[model samples]
Target: MSPAVSPPDARLPHRDARRDAVVDELRRLMARVEGVPKGREGALSFGLSALDQHLPQGGLAFGTVHEISTASEADLPAAFGFLLALLARTPGSAPLLLVLASKKLARCGLPHGAGLAALGLAPSRLTLVETENAAEALWATEEAVRARAPAAVASAIGGKLDLKASQRLHYAAREAGVPLLLLRPGETESVATAATRWRIGAAPGAQDRFGLLAGWRWHANLERCRNGEPRAWMLEFDHATHRFSLAAAVADPSLARGGEAPSLRRTG
Candidate 1:
């Protein structure tokens, strides 16, 4: 006679014991493979050289949930600056959906596509979605995440996301494997469901201001790294040639491991 089966649980479903055994065996067989699968991470490269180095494989992972929050107002750029660069490099830049709850982007246009059309990104690729409230915006943002084909999804929503909603979006983001750029509001101390959490602080400007000092600074911190610590760093975005790179600000022998660079840096 066949083995008797049990009923399913309310919270967690129960499957047949024999079926579970088969799944366990299959998992073990797969674990002994030569190497882990080199799954496709969304092609989200940073236009800035300095910023990409800190991310996974020169960019954020396509399949992971990334939370971007700011500790201070001045540091807000680090969170969105990276997103701007990612959008510029994401494949097929048109139809970029920007679901924003807060009015940061509404008030302050994206630096890449603002003041003038000099930047390569035309007005068409930049689509903005402003909702009536945070709840509506979050729903729309989740929908955008499911649409995954966009270069990137940047949403500046209020810091009132419930855990269940976050989990749903996180699952969708992981499944779709799209780069979700969430702009967490300032002074938010709530928990986040992100594979990586980074806090960015703007450094000084990169070029001379008519008759002033030069260069912009950014302090990036990998607050939560489910992967690994990797490396935490600050960068200098050189505007003369329009290139972003690691800062050589300190030269105390220990931190000067990169050696001397040419007098002038070439930017793109």
Candidate 2:
């Protein structure tokens, strides 16, 4: 009998290498223009290998804008929890700026202090600013970003955030070497200037032997990435460490096509 031959590998190593080189060059140019340093210092790793490995800079890049939106009105709390988790991971004691528009406040209400502590965020570390409208919220966020005083700036503004406004915020963040975490309405049009955009939905969490709940869980869908692939994951935030980890690989039907709202089961 003739010897059986193995098929050649189908992966295109050369193509991937070329693409990575181009991305690196672009990062260098952007670093020069933005006056921000290049390399690992400029990114914030999620501490989850599955996620960090897929990011262009190995994590969420600073000196830029990252947008997050809820899957539905009910998911606003989960989205806010996710934001607090992100802020908790930031490497600084500097006061965090949270700008909110009155319209959004009336719709979603304010963040709770006890919830902040439960999410590994210190209430004293956050500075809250409530604006009368979306315009004022955006203005406050832009000025805060330019000031470079806060470790990060978060804005929960309700309205149509056009590309130009997003670009201005992006540039301000870049110049200040800080991050602008913008929370948009679920149905708002996506902004192009954001380095990455996420849509977060509430998800079922794990239970202990006695059927006790484990931690906060969310369905995170990476809708857009400037230099990476779009993906989704079931994430759990550890309140103790303020880090994210992969939840059990339970299939979520709501994460299916067309972006349907997830039917979240309350643990309490």
Candidate 3:
């Protein structure tokens, strides 16, 4: 008798292949509908592969507002460092304006030219504006954005801003087609019309290429995004280059070679 024909294998891998194909097609369709501009006249890249993928328009929106806040007073420097790194990447020779509330300045101290230069910013290219309070600071930031004189506008507030105030700044930035960065202190979160919101704090120890203490590492959380999911990243700011880079997620402590972790140092 002829051998009975064996039944076709039931565990063939084609099932997975078919599922993957369907998923890929869905992603393509979603991207087409959601993808934002990427080149000049669009958004700015954060220079990190992980982050750009999650941001609306594939990067930070240019004609919109972004917010950054610290978890505590100690984290303020790291948050500010992250902002400075973004300013360093702004595309233009045009000076940028930094508006600060007088109360905020008294508490956080003024930004120094030398310190900014160390972070790859041209001190001369930064125009400082001081206001009496958060309300005035917000107004100045809006006006600066409307003026379009500076390449970007950044405002620092010592306290929280109401939703209406935040919306006004958002509209002004959009109207002028300039980016606006709002920096706030402490843990308070408010309803703001920002394209993205970030929470930043100091990370564990970080070492340079030579295994020596180099710069400060930060835990940056993408708290909110208009077109993407929230995510966290380990970001490092190199004093030598003043550029932000993705830090290794894990490292062997033994490789540090017995050097003590250095304190976070600021220039100026």
lDDT agreement with native, every candidate: 0.59, 0.77, 0.72
Model 3 error, position 220 (Å): 0.4
Between prediction 1 and prediction 3, the one with superior lDDT is: 3
Question: Against the true structure, what is every candidate's RMSD?
Answer: 14.0, 6.7, 9.0
Worst lDDT 10-window in candidate 1? 259-268
The parts of candidate 2 lying over 4 Å away from their true place are: 1-41, 250-268
TM-score, structure 3 vs. true: 0.76
TM-score of each: 0.67, 0.81, 0.76
Per-residue accuracy of model 3 over 36-141 as CA lDDT, tens digit each: 2233245667876666766755567777788888867788877887787788778879999988773633566678788888888888888888888777887788
Best TM-score among the predictions, by candidate number = 2
In what order do the candidates fall by TM-score, top score first? 2, 3, 1
| Greater-TM-score candidate between 2 and 3 | 2
Q: Which candidate number has the best lDDT?
A: 2
lDDT by residue (168-263, candidate 2, tens digit) is 997788878787888886646887788889898998876767897767789888878776667777888766666788776533434333333232
Error of 1 at 130 (Å): 0.7
In model 3, the clashing pairs are none
1-268 in candidate 1: lDDT tens per residue?
A: 3444544455233445657577556643442242212364343655555446445445666655677777576556565665554455557644777777765544555454662132234556778788978888888878887876665677777657778877877777766667777777684654366667766666665455585645556665556654334334555555444345666664132453332222112110
Error of 2 at 44 (Å): 2.3
